[model samples]
Target: MPDVQDCLPTALYRAAQVRELDARLIAAGTPGFELMQRAARAAWRALRRHWPQADEVTVLAGRGNNAGDGYLLAALAQRAGWRVRVLAVGDPAQLGGDAALACAEARAAGVAILPWSECAPLTGVLVDALLGTGLSGAVREPYAQAIRLLNASGQPVLAVDIPSGLCADTGRVLGVAVRAELTVTFIGLKLGLFCLDGPDHCGALAFADLQADPRLLATGVPAAQRLTGAGLPALAPRPRNGHKGLFGHVLVVGGDSGFGGAALLAAESCLRSGAGLVSLATRGEYVAALLARRPEVMARGVRSANEIQDLAAAADVLVLGPGIGQGAWARSLLSGLGALDKPQVWDADALNLLAAGQLTAPAGNWLVTPHPGEAARLLGTTTAAVQADRPAAALALARQLNALVVLKGLGSLVATPSGELYLCDRGHPAMAGAGLGDVLAGLLGALLAQGLTMTAAAQLGVWLHACAGERLGRAGRGLVAADLMTSIRDLLEEHSPCLK
Candidate 1:
């Protein structure tokens, strides 16, 4: 239901924070059961809209307020004359507060209530109310079994509030989480719904306000911001008399031997994304081919670090580490960069070398782009650990490295050294290929050379890069990295035009 960008809340919250917001709303004159009722009504409306042809509904419920939502939905379905069944995963006798009241109402409405077992047959639209924001620790026993069975069921699933067994704050699956076709969340949008494993488990997202007071809802600071177009900081349009000298020069340093195309890809992105002057300091063998391919980029062959000195001095920014191998040659070029006072966008092998302790960040502006594997290596942990809590991992990388860090993957996170974070929820599954990071590295450098601060460059660059991928990704899978360059330039012009 995601509603619309303007209607959907821009800020994302932790599960605890959303729960706190709920408590605040309840304390401010709305009854708890009434809020539960609103959630049920909201969910019911969404369910009917999504599955209007379905005449039967299966509700999986637990013991908390989450289960209360299931019971309330069952009542709504029963009143509407839909054949409804409520399978209680948690004991009904243990229902407390609003949940017990909801159960009584459902029973009064003649909704069939049944105890859940491993073998219960699932049919029609299924509602997941087995767990909510209150979940922590791994799901145990019957709850785990229930989630497994729900996932195994092929019926269209609609998660109530949050998917059962999904961590509302981190989006981590607690051992296992219910996979739903559509997830409807209330009050505030939570972070777990956007990042890490959140996007995978949540089929499609819809948000509801439950008609809460706008003034009251604006109480606390949000956990992170969604990197939507409206929220992105603008790259001011260039003047009519803009010249190449006015915009900074960008030197792309990589393409070790066989990986020459990687460096060329980044250089192409830099030139296309409006970098004033783009240079390529790469393998000697590739110079002839690169000049033929992209003559706009000043191509040079630098066998040793010394060969790059003159080019590096004239450069305004460096796009480093696309296919830069970890051998003596790459190390020498890295050594050459150690003393340069220029902005740098590090990616690919640069991150890999950093993880291996072969190189340190050069003296100047810095932005590091790493996928989950690289991020894990940077943090000296496992990729699984990095993904489990993406926000924490992004922040840790930012603080530890003392640079602007972009942890690239699904729900890419851009974090500043000071701890500010932005989440990019855009992009497509077709981006699961190589050379994408190289394109991103060059784009970031181009933005930085155009005069955006390290943090702002990261945010805007990441948005443009992902938006480009999302555009071409619609053609389906097998998307090549180079396919995104033209779209990247177009999107950049659309957002922050060179000609106003």
Candidate 2:
């Protein structure tokens, strides 16, 4: 995804989670103001590195600690002989605690402090310190006007911590969010900044620990994780004596009457992704067509559940629901296949059926891939609600179904029942076409059959799929499902598991 970096000592955390951790660290003997100063230094370091030659800086300060970080960064910029100005959105008299201290520091550094007005000239690189993790509702009044101006200013922006008005847990924009060219987050990475609107709002993300004792984080659980190729564990190299049987069998059940292309896409993706054997269970009408298209796949068509029992029973990983309608045949096949104990990936109509309460997912070893609409159906909510807080929706779905959840979107989020959350920022808009979900299901299924853990398989599969889509998109539009197969194969070989 978006250029994965080395593992941050600080794992991703939600606003409340990080706030609690901050309190714990203070109770454990570190001063609150000290931590704030550390955060300021970290943000300042990042700002200098990103815009080394930009001497003029403008800071948009609010009432919260996020504003304090901005003021501190302004003070640092002033000390370094860069002309800096702080446009205070909050009454300076209302500032308290470390925020007040940061204000005094900025004033002492000879940085100009101006009260915010409708026509203030916000020049140079704008620093978004207007709001922080504590935001819960829509942006109001002067701040909204100020944010609107900052966005329209066209100057490069470096946000202190998260972008203003973005929910640190859900990545939802509270009416409006400041678009920063770069965001330097401290203490812990906010999970929201990497999902939903996160990737679009926060550009070129950087994380700093603020030198907090690592053990302090152990006291608080993470809200989510940002997946990186470097963070993924390596898959074993193919054994010299490996046989077709050792790689395991995959059963792809779907492709109802006019939708044969969906099932074929999944089956072909599985084959290309290294599944030793891939069997497609579809309408009998398409058997000849499937065989002619992909001869390597064992294409079998079935009219009833009994006809596909042996096939499902033989599979190590079951990829169900691509092109599956809610019709009698689709229901019969899914109902029969759900009884198997193998790891499974349920996508397309399978998810719709699950959401409709027509089918129950097996207890474990399953992944549910749903776009916002499908996820909303499964969660018994609306698509807006799902998109407003994707990270929460993903984790909630995972917990409710006891299955890994892959909520696909701008920044796809993968969540597990145990509360592990990952954001994949590696996809391109060209992947918005049909049949992509089927390909994802096949890739995930193939990885699972190869013995990767559910989380690992989901992570690797998402990374591979997104990276391939990005590469292919560079070749321009009208990419078909078949085009992904070759790109995926090439990417896997180039990536070589966890290496590089």
Candidate 3:
């Protein structure tokens, strides 16, 4: 079998959708108990492969089908000559259907079954089958206590599907959750495992398809698509006779006083990412400095909104925000952009100003990139609320503004006004730094200027930016925003080469 990472499916489904898929699979000739058996065998093989030296196994079983998988795994382990014991968190009398059958099989195989308690000793590899994707509320009772103990045990844990307390639809941790070193999931890939708190709790992820029919799987629509190299939109190769005029021009507007570097970073990123002509309209004080730093950019020191009118008129795409403060000068510049109907990428203070009600969202093809705080401001909610359900927040903002939204965070999302959603899981924690958003905004503008549609540009730009950070992140910390420009250029070339 291929490694989990090597064979990951592009489609991401909500928990309910996955359950529906499960039902559909069972209805299409596969029996429920047989599916459970397959799940157990898949997880068992993963556990042995991940920790071959372990001779003992402890199973934490609940009452549902998830528990059935655990009980069946215990039987397999016992039969293989490995010492195995099951700590039943849910009462055995409560189990019905296949779970009861699994328990009987475990007993027949001589697997020791014990009720869970605080005093029970945990040994060998711990299997967390306490809760599954069906959990919608906070964990309660002995299950919560069991999850807490599992987290504190310092034992290597392999979660049966998802970590017990993770919200499979949203990736939110419901009050408390078990942190597993390796999570072997079955059937479909849950959206929760790749976003928010999911990545932190699910350490090394593995997946098994359980031999579901591909044609049947295709009948269900996924909630979102994970961004991968296989089907990403790409720029067409440049013709040999292509000239600077053949590509479009991009104008970056922002940089209020002390925030000049932000606009410069955007302009530099735009130029390197293949914008034919990149210009910066900012405070006059930074013109000479911008020229000195990157002479390729046509840097202009604009004092008022009127100064940017000509630049905007000539530009094919505009990148707004990026250190544009919310003062008189920033307002003036924003006012100048009000009448322009060109495609734009809004970020940083531009989003802040919009959230502050300084201006109505312009009518045209545009994209807004907002972090969690900015997203909250735009949605008229708290940052915590936006973080709690990022996908919902992103879609809401996109629909409300009638524009594409790139909700930048751990699992960055690109949401279209039409309700299409794409997620980028390629970034690293080391990318948590300043000015990265600026680079992203600039790259987005360049892609738009080069003729990609709003949705296509947002998806490709986000993937390239995150992939660049992932590559640079391998060196550890101390990663600055400027470091991604070259890597992004390289990735863009690799994805869409200049020569055919």
Highest lDDT, which number? 3
Question: Which runs in model 2 stand beyond 4 Å of their true positions?
Answer: 1-3, 7-10, 494-500
lDDT of 3 by residue, 223-299 (tens): 89998876789899999999987788999999998999999999999988899999899998999998999999999
Better of 1 and 3 by TM-score: 3
Model 2: residue 264 alpha-carbon error in angstroms: 0.6
* lDDT (Cα atoms) of all candidates against the true structure: 0.89, 0.86, 0.92
TM-score of 3: 0.98
* TM-score per candidate, chains pooled: 0.96, 0.93, 0.98
- Winning model by TM-score: 3
- The collision pairs in model 3 are none
Expressed as tens digits, the lDDT of each residue in 195-270 for candidate 2 is 7788899998888777778887776777766667667644567867788898779999999988999999999999
Clashes found in each candidate (C-alpha, N, C closer than 3 A): 2, 1, 0
Candidate order, TM-score descending: 3, 1, 2
Pitting candidate 2 against candidate 3, the one with the higher lDDT is 3
Error of 1 at 66 (Å): 0.6
Give me the displacement of residue 354 in model 1, in angstroms. 2.1
Error of 1 at 315 (Å): 1.2
> What does candidate 2 score in Cα RMSD to the true structure?
2.4
